[model samples]
Each structure stands twice: as C-alpha cells, then as structure tokens.
Target: MGEAYKLDCDICAYTENIFVGFGLLYMRLESIASFVQDAALKRRIEEFIGNPSTRYDAYDALYVCPVCQAIRNELFIEMESDSSQYKISYACPRCASVMQQEHIENNVPVHLSCPACEKGKLKATFYMDWD
Candidate 1:
C-alpha cells in the first residue's frame, strides 16, 4: 500500500501534500510504464518489462530541487538495460533544476527547508494510507 504525507512549515503557513509507495496498478509492469511521463523513460521501462533480466524500480515519491530547494511529487522510475546502462533525471518544474529523490518511510519526519518560506522548516507528517 501507499502512504500520504503533509508537509507544514514550522514557522510559516507553507503546506503541501505528497503521496508515496505502490498502488495495486503499480504492480503491473505496463501500468507502471504508463505512469512515467517521459517518453524515453517509458520506453526503457517497457523494454525491461519485455526482458526481466534488466532490473527496474518505480514508485511515487518526493523529489527536491537542489538549486532552488523546490519540492515536487512525481513518479520515480529507474531501469537498467541489458548493457547495464540507464539514466533518468527529473527537472524541477519551478526552476528547471535537477531533482533528487527524498523518502518518507515509516512515517519518519522529513525535515526540509520550506520552499515558500525559506526561513521556516518543513516537517513531514503522516496523514493516511493510500492505494
């Protein structure tokens, strides 16, 4: 099952919600491939589905833009081809910077600098179960 979390700023009103983990449909290779927005990435995932030798992992997760400190919720997909070469990068929607994956597991708090109010800290709080 998946999980939902809400991030609230300790000193400001900044708030955002993120959903992470796998749903029932995510278990299906085709469905997971379809969920990827990048055409090239989707094709790579499809190739992995066709040949199971190439390992792959896909999930809904939080991503942070190092340059702008922006937060984004997106489908994180990774797949290695037979040649053991696979590369995927997600650009920050706000600043066009590369985004790094962040995990919110077991309801552990993910402390972050608030994108909206930089002075405040964003605290991740488990809200509910999803999927």
Candidate 2:
C-alpha cells in the first residue's frame, strides 16, 4: 500500500501534498514508463519490461535540491539489468543541480529542511493509505 502526506513548514507556512510508495498500477511496465515524461528515460524503462534479469523499483518519493534547496515530489525509479545500472537522478529545475532523495522513516519524512525558507524543518502529516 502507498501513503499520502501533507508536508508543512510552520515558520514559512510552506505546504505541499505529496503521495509516496508504489501502488498496484505501478506493477505494469507500461504504467511505470508512462510516469516518466522524458523520452530517454521512458525508453530505458520500457527496455526492462518482461526481462527476467531486470531488477527494478518504482515509487513516489521526495527529493531536495542541495544547491538550491528546492523540493520536488517525483516518481522515483531505479533498475539494473544485464550489469547496467539504470538509476534515476532528478535535477533541480531551478538550479540545474543534482537533487538528493529525502529520508523517510516509518513512512514519514524525517530531518527535512524547509525548501521555501531554509530555516525551518518540514513536518509530514499522514492523510491516507493508497493502493
């Protein structure tokens, strides 16, 4: 099952509703590939479909840009097939810097700094279960 969260920053009043985890629909290769808007990324993911040796994981995840302190909720996908790594890394839309995955514990994000203010921590509030 997947989960949804409302992340808020008390001091800055920054807020965002995000969904995390893979749902049943994510099991299909076509479904997963569709989530990727980049043509190159979509092609790479499609190649892994139905391959016995292909090992992959797909989920909704939170990413933070280290350079710009921007936050993004994105579909996270990683795969390894035929000794080739297919890890997905997101670039900060604002700064063009490589973004880092945010830490989550017990389905809740932890140690997250507010991307808006950069002074307050983010609080994750669970809203519901999905899939």
Candidate 3:
C-alpha cells in the first residue's frame, strides 16, 4: 500500500478571486466613463443618480402559455383592417410557435408542437429583466 498524506489547511489558498476581478472591472469602468461623451447618456446617468425611483421598467408585459408554461414577449402588429388598433402576438422560443395574444392569454397554444413528446402541451410565461 502507498503511504498516506496528512491534510494541511495552512497551505491551502482560500482568498476570493472574484473580488480582485471586480476591482479590475471598476478600473475598466472608470476608463470607459472617460471615453463616453453622449449627452443623453450623461443625462440618464444623472437622472438615475438624482432620482433612483425613475428607473426603467425591465419587464415586458406578456401572456404566458398554460401547458408548457413558456414565456413570450408581447409585440403589437397592425391588422389588415381599417382599425388603428394593433393585434398582439406571442412567440415561443423553443417551438417557434407564433400565437395570438387572446389565445395565449386564454392559455391556448395555437401553432406550436412539442419536440420532445410530439404532443401539443406547450405553455408560456412572461419575464422581465433590468438593464
């Protein structure tokens, strides 16, 4: 049998590397801020600094599917009719199914089939993220 080695905690390095990387990132951010000269960007930064509550809304309001629970971003499309109102449509990322907003809101899958089981059990959900 081979000789066993004793565990040594003193030799182990446990320092956080992420914090060092973040410090370097902050340096890079300062350099980038010096290069940016757009007036709109400056105004936006000032607004964010002055009134933090006036932040951009991250979520795109959408209807989700009932079966598969897929999240879809709602987009407005003008209808062929004379009405000025636009119709909403939801698209599934996995199945590439384009469904009308009314049907998706009602929890119905209009044009997508599940690739795994070949069943029409697709669903949708809405999601949002901050910039």
Which candidate gets the maximum lDDT versus the true structure? Answer: 2
**What is the TM-score of candidate 1?**
0.84
Instruction: Kindly give the stretch of ten consecutive residues in candidate 1 with the minimal lDDT sum.
Output: 79-88
Name the best candidate (by TM-score).
2
Name the Cα RMSD for model 3.
19.4
The number of clashing residue pairs in each candidate reads 0, 0, 9
Residue 72 Cα positional deviation in candidate 1, in Å, after optimal superposition: 0.9
Q: Which pairs clash in model 2?
A: none
| Candidate 3 local lDDT, 7-28, one digit each (tens) | 1122232111000001221232
- Each prediction's whole-model lDDT (CA): 0.80, 0.83, 0.32
Question: Which pairs of residues collide in candidate 3?
Answer: 64-124, 65-124, 68-122, 68-123, 69-123, 70-123, 70-124, 70-125, 71-125
Which ranking of candidates, highest lDDT first? 2, 1, 3
Candidate achieving higher lDDT, 1 or 2: 2
Report the candidate with higher TM-score, 2 versus 3. 2
- TM-score-based ranking: 2, 1, 3
C-alpha lDDT of residue 9 in model 2:
93
